[model samples]
Target: MDCLISVDGSVTVSLLKSIFFIINVLFYLNYILKNNIKKMNTEPLNLVNGKIMTLNESFPIVESLTIKNGQYYSLNNPHPNFKTINLNGAFVIPGFIDAHFHIKNLGQRLDMVDLKGTKSAEEIENLIYNKSKTLKSGEWIEGFGWDQNLWNDKNFPSSELLNKTIQNNPVYLTRIDGHSAWINNVAAKVSNFDLSTNIEGGSIVNDCILIDNAMDPIRNSMPKPNKDSTKKWLLSGAQYAAERGITNVHDAWQSPEIIESIIELVQENNFPIKCYGMIGGSFKDFLVDFFAKGQYSGKQYKLRSVKAFIDGALGSRGAALHEPYHDDHCNCGLILISKEEFDELASLCYDNNFQLCTHAIGDRGNSFVLDTYQKYLKAQNDRRWRIEHAQMLTTNDIGRLKECSIIASMQPSHCTSDMKWMKSRIGEHRLHRISRWKTLLDNGIVIAGGSDCPIEEGNPLHEFYAAITRTDHDGFPKGGWQSQEKLSRIEALNLFTKGAAIAEFSENNRGMIEVGYEADLSILSNDIMTIESEKILKTDVIATIVNGNIVYGNKNF
Candidate 1:
């Protein structure tokens, strides 16, 4: 009886093992069958045009697709059956490319306080006063985004008034343009400079408004935030950028430390936004070291460019001009860097496979940059060097830009924002040529758009409105300022998308909704092309996709 029981137990264990094997086999077969059924149901679509245009009525409606190796590997193509995504019944466009962003500065500005909507000088003072009252006495109080134009009286506030209002705290408030700063006496003292100290490329106004180089002391005095804080700030900035449909940015000036931090974030799969960094001349070695490591080959983070300042901005009366400022005759404008210096740098960039992007606002500055590009570009043909800001250009300089093949990294919002005071600064004659997008486009110049964030909010729609309408925030001019210079909806979109992608040497990979391109796209809540120009500002981004993944979206479906 014991032997019989043992035999039965052995048979029971064998049967149980066989049953488990059969179940496993059946599960595997079921999975294969389910996948095959899915493949049969989903159809592959190949997109070629800017939009998902339907040309043939007989073509199968695409239910799913897989873009493999920059080509559509679909049911009809030579790829194995697999699942895919189909963006049906929706317009598709390339993701936005901000070609001239000061992303690092934007990151730093995130941690700083903002006072943009201050209505009057007293209101700005009160803002600092209230914030200072909460902090310990003598501690530095920093704020940004104060536009004098929004005030009851459109004029810069005196630092003396700030000092009187915030007696205990050392206050530093930056103008909306970021070209000027109002520093209290206590803040000046803490910066270790009084009325006597003057730094190069900057000025200290009589009432203690620091401009350009004059900001060095105050900037140096402020302690850099800790690593975690910096990371938090950068993350905040990135998330904000993504939500606005800005998938890629060409950061104008960056240090090695900042690049390291960005790389760390990318390694940890933390950073969602793609960045192309340009290391300034002051941080050239950082870029050199990075390139030496052969790490510049990545698609997300690159450091193969250098940004140099040829002159200051027009708002600050420091833009290098052929003639004196129309409003301030005494100041012909400042030349922060000479042509020879820029030429040498350009040559260095050419030899090292680095592209040079110089800030040239005024016609004089633009001419100088053009000459430098001409000198260096003869030796290296592939170097797509750029002239940052390329704001005001003489007709002669416009021709030179086309000859040199330089990219015009411009901000359309600058045109609308500066139009109010641009004529006053350069006279109507020069103002006519200022921000000449029409001539640039006609002459075949590559115009890449950006917001220069922190200085201007990184809103692509605002840029589009500014480019097409050529109107200020309030919708100035019944028709438009330089109505002839207005870009078509498609042209404006290209400036922020395809043109920007070309500036960063990423045109082949991004900038369109073609099948072979990177799956970087922005979906709008409304059709942009059909929308009224005035209503463009009201339209919002519904979703942003980067690298085949949804990074930002406001809707559920």
Candidate 2:
């Protein structure tokens, strides 16, 4: 990850940071000189004209953009001699950055059997039944996006029920949150498991469904998606993101092989979007070698951190809560790891100067993680470690985030997805405690927005619509679930731009439309800033520019 020392040479992280800073300053100076077209010295290639929202307070709006060396050289000072393409006053903004997406999962899911919006268990069975006809004996049938909570019965299924439809092959279907899975009897035998067996942080509910670590072994048994397929899926995923005006994505919990492939893609310029990866926990053994290498920053890739899971997601009722679940009163939840284990890992990361991005969801989960963080961090340091999710927090735990300077890498679409059933699972009292975007920002905590794709649609506009409005797909609860906690459109934009850049420790030059900032921008068909909140979702991307190159859109300008 982005550690201090390097295995290659004497190139230190501090030295690299200095180099990047110098590069920013130099580029800014270069842009300013070339942009002074009033003198008319240098000839520029293409000039773009539109209503550009720089997101920089110094200069909020610009009429024209001068391009040189594929960078936003200057604003409003276009050369009279060069071709200036006008957009008929389209709205342009900085390319959106998804702060908590997993590129590998998105690619993997592209090839898997989809179960996203299946209304009931019967629908899921019917979907799997059709796929079973094509599978041979002993072959694994894998599917994703099954939510028991979304079903009519709102209860877990049995292995017998799964066995009835998926008789030919062992079938395993993952829950929407990815924290749980439902399996058939054949898969149970294939997984070498007994229903009576006990696991630490996961469970086999109703003798069929596996939660958290319990699902890992079965998942591992399934053949991995090949590199070619991965590349194909990644290309499609990237195209979708680019079309929606996404410039960069955080590839959370990536494997070493995928990371290497990503590196190759960047080198070959085959990767579609700029990817920032978080090494998965399975590669803990490679931490020393990985950390020694420090940061890998190329045109399309950067691996700067390690990822770990502290507890299960709240959706599967596996989140480690301080109290028992309101729905299942007998069960509190699952704790994926021990306090000592988390502390050991935290210390390892802290000692090696690596960023530890832990996934925490429930109240107890957040508390335990914060305590571990406080133990190692006696004094505040610039260790930009993040709490991925930081979903559920008590009233007292809010300030601890500011004290530790932990970045809240949250997905806005999660709120809209869960709001329909949030109170049913957590009870009314606890409902008032969670996801408080405004409260988090009000207490000096830094927030970055995203769509945890494969779980929720990774559309930037959908997330922005949710963040600013705090409403569901149907625009429920007219005033919003908690209107008091809503963020403004500008604040929501920053969550995907500047706020995201700060979380990634790249705020010096990126996130804003400045002379030094990377010329990664998104142009839209409509002016979202002045439009009504409901109409924000109607805004279409006219073009997407990354590093000043048109990667998506037919609007050649």
Candidate 3:
């Protein structure tokens, strides 16, 4: 009996020993799996055999680079354990960043009737008439990219033309600058637009046109895009940007719904490019909510700025100027926001630690914004308050930009586009102060370049060409309009890279191909740095890399 009891105790000990061994084996296997994943996640990606424009003062250029976990790891270093891509001697620069863009509008424009380059009012009317036929009766017919400046008549088209084309549908079309809209009587009646209504900062230019805040009633009456359409538009716009070698965009204005949609896309890993959003001032309630929520900085999105408009576009003569327009003796343009209101807005942004970007196109508009910004911002503080367009400025006010540490967020294309008739609008006397990129740069005031897409072509190449040449696509005016203001090739590149990055407070991690920076790059078919001015427009985007992954094109690997 004693021998049997001892045998049972031995078997019990053996069973316990077997269980412990199995547990140890399982734990070891789990440990191996986890570690393998960790290593894979941290593994480096090497790029070799390329002309890399680092834009780094220290390195400047490199033949190769290594990326680890989506950040630049090292220059001219290749890891044996990681994957390597040969760029085949392509010219690679920091990925282009559009400092100002309208993502939603760009996307929606893709589906709308494109009236760009329409030479006459008759052409636009025909385009709308054709578009109207596709939709059912009463469906809104929307179009964009129409500029009366491009027309031979060079006058605002009467709504009677649209009325003659399609009376059954409500037609709404926006001017290229987006500061004004031309609507038929049908749309005006639908929006309950009353000509007698007193709009403080807007004007109803006859029955056809509404300028600035005057168009709000019509816009509010329009149906808002639902979630699905919003998502589609955002994705489409982002893809369009990616294709253009743009990896980051500072969306100039965003609604709460659009911002939420962007967040959702980023969370789902559906968004391919990084977006820095500036909440629209129109959304007052959302601004209050966002201030309470503080700023959001994610892998692919950020929201920390608010965009306000002090005036309108110069093309539409809605930009508030100190003196009357040369073309219209009695008109000095409109001020969208009064100085008192602007001051209050500035206080809100300053107190909430949000960046303030104001649209100030004319001299008077710019002065008002500069004064308001000075009241809230201390000298040499890093507020980074920006004057969008900064189109027209007085000589005295130029120094104020430096005093306030303001960023001149100018669109190079605007200069070229407006050169055709800008002199007639403001006269030659004030021309020197318009889009003074070189002067602004010399004064130690940073100038961030952008296309202001949907208003312009939104192509980085176009922006670069326009900046350096100060000419249109055809290279007009021989020596370039405002030749002294033209930026050098490298300087032009910096406007879209370093300048843009600095504006968004991402210079340390982006804008340069330095070690430990984000692996964002734009590979071009030709060396834009050495290419001829006219050929710059012909240059093709070979590949656009964001976070060390190819998002658009795959020429080499």
Highest lDDT against the true fold, candidate = 3
Q: How many Å off is the CA of 325 in candidate 1?
A: 1.7
Candidate-wise lDDT, in order: 0.72, 0.78, 0.86
Question: Predictions ranked by TM-score, top down?
Answer: 3, 2, 1
Q: Write the per-residue lDDT of candidate 1 for residues 36-59, one digit (tens) a residue.
A: 311111133333212331111242
Per-model TM against the reference: 0.84, 0.90, 0.91
Which candidate's TM-score is highest? 3
| Candidate 2 lDDT over residue span 467-499, tens digit each | 888888678879888677788888888899998
Pairs of colliding residues, candidate 3: none
> For residues 88-149, what per-residue lDDT tens digits would candidate 3 score against the true structure?
88889999999999998899989988988889999988888888888888889988888988
Ranking by lDDT: 3, 2, 1
- Relative to the true structure, candidate 1 has a C-alpha RMSD (angstroms) of 16.0
- TM for candidate 3 is 0.91
List where candidate 3 sits over 4 angstroms from the true fold: 1-43, 554-557
lDDT comparing candidate 3 with the true structure: 0.86
lDDT of 1: 0.72
Clashes of each: 2, 0, 0
